[model samples]
Target: MLKKRNFPAVDLIALEREACRRSLATFAQRAWHVLEPATPLRWGWALSAMCDHLQAVSRGEITRLLMNVPPGTMKSLLTGVIFPAWEWGPAGKPEKRFLSTAHMQTLAIRDNLKCRRLIQLEWFQSRWPVQLQDDNNAKLRFENTATGFREAMAFTSMTGARGDRVLLDDPLSAADGNSDAALLAAELAFLETLPTRINNDHSAIIVVMQRLHERDTSGLILSKGLPYTHLCLPMRFEPDRRCETNIGFRDPRIKDGELLFPERFPEAQVAELERTLGSYATAGQLQQRPVPRGGGLFKREWFGTIPALPVGCRFVRGWDLAATEDAEAAATAGVLMAQAPDGRFIVADVARAQLGPMGVERLMRATAEQDRAAHGAVRGSFPQDPGQAGKAQAQHLLRHVLTGFDYHFSPESGDKETRALPLAAQAEAGNVFLLEGPWNAQFLDEIALFPMGKWKDQVDAASRAFTELTTKRQASSSSGTLRGFF
Candidate 1:
C-alpha cells in the first residue's frame, strides 16, 4: 500500500532529481486540479491577475505585463508553459501566440520547443505536429477558436512576421544579465522586435524574467516605467503555503513556527545576497521589489536633521576641477573647515557643476577668500597636478588673489567612494556639520550619491585634505612642534 502523503507538504528530497525539470509530468506543469505545493493562494492570485492582464490585453484593459520572480519558483512554468496550455482551451488546443525568449537565440528556440512538447503529449496530441510554417528554426503556429492563427519565434530573424498575442517571457535573461553585454543586447533586440512584430496595437506583450542587477534591462524597465504586475516570492513568502505557486493569504504552508526558511534557503546563501547587494538591489533582485529607484542611497528623511557648523572655526577649501558643461561631465569642489583647539573638522560644502578649469580656479579662489573673511583666515588646496606648470599656477594664485593666504598642493590615490565612505559615514551619523547657508542645498544633494569606485573629484579632494591635515597634525605633535596643524 502507498504511504499517506502529509497535508500541505511534499517530500522535496524525492523531487531532488529534477531541480530544473521541463517535462509536463511534473505536478507543477500539467494541472492544478489537485492542490499542488507552492504559494498556492499567491500563485492562484497571480494567475488570476495574469488572466485578467491577458484578457485586458485582448480587450485592451492594459497593454504590457512585466512579471519578475526569483529562481526555483517557476516563472516560465506558470506564465509560459502552464498558462499557455490552459489558454489553449485547457486540454491543449494549442492556443496563444507565445514567443518565450532567453538571452540567446537558441534558448528562445528551446522554450518554443518545450511548449510544443507539452501540446504533443499523448493526452493532447490533437495539438501535435505543431504545423510547419518553419519548425526547425523556431517559428510556431496554431489555431485558436476566437483569435485565429498564433505564432512564436526566438528573438533572432523575426522580420515582418506578426502575432495577435505576444508573450515575451524572460527577455533580459538572468543567465547573461550580470557578465555579458552580447546577451543583454540580444534580449533588448528581442524586446524591440516584439512590439514591431505585433500585428496591431491591440496585441499584448507579457514579460517574465528573473531580476538580475541594477543596470540590467529589467532594471532599466523598472527604472523608467512599465505597466505590469510585479510579483516577488522570496523563500519565506509563506511558511504554511506548501505550494509556492499558490501565494494565498490562508496558505497552508505558512504557520507561526514552521521551518520553511531553512528548507527553502540555506543561511549561507541568503547571507551572501544581503552582504553583496545594495538595498535597492536586495529589494529588486532578491526580494523582487518594484520601483527600486524610489529607495535611492540618500533618502529625503536624511535631509532635515543636518546640523549647523560651529562658530570660530577657520576653513580651508579643496577643489577637483572639471573643464566643461558638455553633456557628460560635472565640475566639483570640496570645502573642509576645522575648529582650532580640538583640531576637529566639519566638512562644510560641496560645489559640483559643469565649468571650465580656469573658471573653476577663479571660483575656488573667490569662495575660499569669502569664507576666510568670515573665519579670520583660511587656505586653498589643489591636487598638485604633478607638473612644473601646475605648481607655478598654484604659486601664482597664492601671490595674486589670495594675498596673505596659504596654498598647498595635494595628490590623491585609490577610489573616491572607498576614500569617502568613512567620511560620508561620519556625516550621515551626525558627527559632521555643515556651514548653514544657501550653498547647503546644492552641497548636500551633490554629495549624496558621490559616484562609485572612480575618484569623484570633490569627494576625493575633501577626503585627501582631511588625510593631509590629520597626518601633519599627528606628525607635528610627535615631533613636538608648535601646533597640531589643521
Candidate 2:
C-alpha cells in the first residue's frame, strides 16, 4: 500500500563543499557539535554578532577589533578556539599565523589544547585535511603542514613573538587590573611591545576582555581614538545604548534590563551575579564601564564626627535590603540618623548584615524594636524602587514585617549619583556629623567611596535617611506642626 516513496538523492560531494562554505558562526556550532555533541550549543544573538566581527577581521576587512563580553559567555571558546580552527580549515587559510596571549600561561595553553583537539577531530580532519607538522606539535605552540602556526604565550613573554594575527584574551586578571603597577605594566606591554610582534603592516590585532579598570587595555586603546571596530556585549541590555558590529548587525534587545543570553543564564542568575560582584565591579566587568575609585563625588575627609547623639533629636532608620544569605551577596544596611533642632544631621548607628528574605524581615523587626526602645518613637524610611516588582516588595515588607511601625515608603527618583549629591554637598560643607560608634570605619569607607565602592548599601541607606530627615523636618518647621519625641 505504499504509493511509491521517493526521496531526493543525497549530494554528498556538494554537501561537503557547502559545509566548507559555512560561516564562522556555523563553523563554531559544528565544531562544538563535534567536540561536545551531547551538549548542544546555545546560539544567542551576541555570539552571532561576535562571530561576524571576528570573521571580518579574518578576511582583512578590519584591522583591529576590540570585543568586550562578560565572563562565562563563551568569549574564549568562540574567539580563541573556534575562530582559529575555522580560519585554518573551512576558510582555507592554513598559511595564516596566529599569536595568542593571556594574562596567564595556563589560560593560553587551555585554548591551545582546545584548538588542537578541535583540528584533530575526525569530522574536522575529514572535511579539511590539514595535518600537523611533525616535531612541532606542543601545548604552547603548533604548526601545520602549510607553514602556518599558532603560538600561545603569557602576556609577559610577548617581546620575541611574531604573527600575522595577534589575539590578547584577558591581558590582566581581576587582581592585576586593580593594581596600579600591574595595570601600568600591561598598558606598556600593549602599547610598546605587542604591536612589534605583528609580522607585517597588514597584520590584524584583536583584544577580547571585560572592562576591568579605567586604565586597562580596553580603556587605554579606546582613549587613543584609534580606528578599532568595537563590539561590546553586556550581560544585561541598557536602554538607549546599542553596540553595532561593522558587518551591520546591531544589538537586538530593545528593552531595558533584557538579558543577553537568557537561554544560558536566566534573569535571576544574572541578578545573583550582579549582587555578588557588587555595583562598582559589575559596572565595569558586566556593564563595560570601569568607574574610577577616587573619582567619586564624595570625599572621605568631608565626614565630621560628634562625641555623642544630641538629646531630643528626631531619629529615623533608613534601610537598603539585599535579602540573600549568601556571603558574596550585597549586605542589607540599616542606618540610624538624627536631625537636630539647629538643622544639623548626625548618624547615630549603622547595622549591616547578609541575610535571606526571612532573616532580613527578622532583622528589620528587631532593629525597629531596639530603635523604639532607645529613641521612644523612631520613623523608618524605605526606598520604593521603580517598577511594579519594586512596589510589590515594598508592600510586602509593609504588610508582613513593618506592621504597627511608623514608616514612610518614598519612591526613589534619579540615579545614585544624583540622589547622593545633596548629602555629598552637605558633608563637604562640614554640616553632617558621625556619632562615635563601632560602625564608624566601615560606614565612612563606604561613604567616601560612594559610587565606586564594591558595597554601596551603607551609602544608599544613609542617603535615604538624610533625605527623609531633612525633608520631614523642613515640612514640619514650615507648617508650624513641629512635635517633640521623648
Q: What Cα-based lDDT does every candidate model obtain?
A: 0.51, 0.82
Compute each candidate's TM-score over C-alphas.
0.58, 0.62
Q: Write the per-residue lDDT of candidate 1 for residues 118-151, one digit (tens) a residue.
A: 5556443332234433333334544444443444
Cα RMSD (Å) per model? 9.9, 16.8
The digit string of per-residue lDDT tens for model 2 on 275-390 reads 99876678778888775233356766777888977777999898888888887458999999898888888989998999988888899889998999989889887776677787
Candidate 2 — which pairs collide?
none
Top candidate (lDDT): 2
Best by TM-score: 2
Model 1 CA lDDT for position 217: 50
Q: What is the lDDT of candidate 2?
A: 0.82
Query: C-alpha displacement of 471 in model 2, angstroms?
Result: 27
RMSD of 1: 9.9
TM-score: model 1 vs. ground truth: 0.58
